[model samples]
Target: MKASAAMRTALQRQWQEGGWLSWLLFPFSLLAAAAVAAKRLAYRAGWRRAERVGVPVVVVGNLYVGGTGKTPFIVAAAHALRERGHRPGIVSRGYGAAIGPVPRVGCGTLDPAVFGDEPALIARQAGVPVAVHPRRAEAARTLLHQHPDVDVILSDDGLQHLALARDVEIVVQDERGIGNGLLLPAGPLREPASRLRGVDAVVTNRSGGRDGTLPTPPAGVRAVDMDLVIDSVWRLADGERRPLPALPAARRIAAVAGIGNPARFFATLRRAGIRLDATVGLPDHYDYAHSPFAAIEADLILVTDKDAVKCPAPDDPRVWAVSVSAHLSDPTFFDWLETRLHGRTPA
Candidate 1:
């Protein structure tokens, strides 16, 4: 009825076959390709300016849209910088915000509606200064002025924000990698794979057969592996935390996710052995104003940390949010990052 659940699989096969599907979409892809090329050309030719702040800026972003673990990577990077004694602050474009002009985020000071969900999540998790502006350069400047002591600026999801010059660029990729390797509408790539040639590093979030290995990089581009760690679960209403209960061990549960990868969330819940009464996958960054709460009459409502931010105070005491961390396995990854941030090995 809904086309087919194998839509993505079919698209990938079609893409690999290089047939009419690819040709039919060639014009659209070409247009997207041209726009991306022009944007990069403007930056290269100095027609577009890239603003550099006083401190080093590290950008954590993805080529594909939706959750590729960029936010978690940002948190890990900020923590890493802090451990090395480099005071780190974050800046974002504040996607989905209704208000703008360089908004500042601090403890208990930002509204998700104005600063967007990810910035608020970063501010809350990093416990460091965060700022948002449509113009990332302005956001970086505002953050630096507000917290002059911050020694490093981390730009969340700014791989394509060429206007904000960055010292380090970390492109995060999920299991989908570039996703059929086509540009928007036709597939999921926001920029061509060639664009990754210039980045400082590549971090893959999850490891699956597809999109598992890092793409061929340009000379000097480093590839690394990163994993997501679900530390524990928390009550969504008031942030009361708990360990993820042993899975397949629980019954009468409902899993909710308003993130880029809803299926992943659902799969995680299923793996935990919890018999899901229902799975509610809201659009990414959903405000939760019209979430199907009526359908969630289960004993427990499990959600991701990102979704918990927007959900109303849980009407039922059983609603919980799972908070996750990104862990990089390569020792060299941190070593390289430390060198970039501090110009020396961390003590």
Candidate 2:
């Protein structure tokens, strides 16, 4: 069963207080924990060998199940590496998309129904080679063979992808951090907090705080601050460029978000002084085939960039996509990344 807002909030509070509810669900949590442990053990015991290709593989992912800015970070990382003269390709499981063979990305040819929203967004935003497969290793191999000039591979949300060997692992955490610090069905974490001990770096979208803040990184694990900043706003489908509307003028906007945290999107709009006359929060990567807001009237329709990828221009002229970029404040993270890339065997 899907969790309610009240249940989610209670779970978070229970985690903070170490309440009895956590204990009541401890039995199931234990099973989930055991499964994660066993999976890791299998990889460690050499029973499941991780495939390592010649090119460097950098994975940006989070321990939590919900969104933590992984897609934006991957887009930013691809841009960063490209600026430094590195050809980077992306691989994703294409979550929420129908399973299929390795798929290619191209203008008007990339199908969101087959490759998922984030992968399609990355392809459109980065304009770089992208391949999607349930098995990321397979996709990476295909990407490398198709575009042999690529020097590195950036895997979007692949912390748990044991089959694909990686040279650098960057763990991403948002304001929620590891919500309630509990496993699935009870909390938000996909794995235990201790699993973060081995990653190359830890990056937090928010700057600081305790609750709703990322934890301090362990020694040898670098910590960095990352922020998602909007660049510009554009009319939906028409692709007509326009300045972000002033708060007073945008007070009656209708906001729509098909992401892990729709509330976060709404809060951002509210902070921008946009009066949300209505807000529709659909499941993550929701397709726009049948929208609930067809009957609702509004002056403007605001959406995230990820959602815009599935809904191309002119089809929804009133829609505007809010583009965000991930900014890293720490230099050490880049220094380490450069070192790793330089050390890789020449491709």
For model 2 the TM-score comes to 0.88
Worst 10 residues of 2 by lDDT: 242-251
Q: Please, what is the TM-score per model?
A: 0.88, 0.88
lDDT over C-alpha atoms for residue 213 of model 2: 53
Tens-place lDDT per residue, model 2, 1-347, is: 12554555565567555567777877788799999999999999999999998899998899877676788888888887887888989988888787666455442236788778888888888878888887889888888888899999999888998899999899988777776778865666788999889888888875222246556788878788786766667766667765565322543578887887676777766665567888776677778776545554876788898888776445656678887677788745565686777875321
lDDT of 2: 0.76
User: Which candidate leads in lDDT?
Assistant: 2
CA lDDT of every candidate: 0.76, 0.76
Clashing pairs in 1: 247-272, 247-273, 248-272, 248-273
Q: What does each candidate score in C-alpha RMSD?
A: 3.4, 3.6
